[model samples]
Target: MIIDEQWIYCPVCSNKTRIKVRYNAELKNFPLFCPKCKQENLIDAKGFQIIVIKEPDAKTQSR
Candidate 1:
């Protein structure tokens, strides 16, 4: 059986991160730290698709 693997890229700087995921791997609200950009972001990954979770601005949010 052959397993497929893919590299995860940073959504902020669009650089390759140090994370690797398998073809069948799944993640929700995962905290990913990018060494290239040095930014921490939350991501949801399934299969080979990665979606970055955006945070709302404090000033724009209703108090």
Candidate 2:
């Protein structure tokens, strides 16, 4: 499905973004990136919810 916008932002960036959805051949996963912070995000096409709030990853949580 084609979308009007094509990028998205990290949760810390107010979740305001419009990222492109693409397949990663290495991980076999669909990944999105934050335009503002340039952070990479993983969003499952089949199960991910729109306007979803992302939790900090293990690395970020440790900080």
Candidate 3:
């Protein structure tokens, strides 16, 4: 498992953030998270790159 450099939206702040795909050796599933938001995101290590969809004008949204 490897960490991929991917960008996604932060749900809390509605801001763009960098996400990473990490392989969890101890867990059965892969662990994911938003670097900026610090939110836990679940993922499949063997699956393709995950795409995070954001709402319209998400960039302008405030907390």
Query: Each candidate: what lDDT?
Result: 0.92, 0.50, 0.47
The numbered model that scores best in lDDT is 1
Candidate 1 off by > 4 Å = 1-3
For model 2, state the Cα shift of residue 36 in Å: 0.5
Q: List the lowest-lDDT window of 10 residues for candidate 3.
A: 21-30
Please, what are the lDDT tens digits per residue for candidate 1 over residues 1-63?
Answer: 675998998988989999999889999999999998789999999988999999898989996
Candidate of highest TM-score:
1
For model 3, residues 6-55, the per-residue Cα lDDT tens digits are: 44445456566564433332223334456666775444332334434333
Error of 1 at 48 (Å): 0.6
TM-score, per-candidate, Cα-based: 0.85, 0.36, 0.30
* TM-score of candidate 1 against the unseen true structure: 0.85
Per-residue lDDT value at 48 in model 2: 27
Model 3 ranges off by over 4 Å:
1-28, 45-63
Q: Clashes in model 3: which pairs?
A: none
Q: Predictions ranked by TM-score, top down?
A: 1, 2, 3
Model 2: number of backbone collisions: 7
> Which one wins by TM-score: 2 or 3?
2
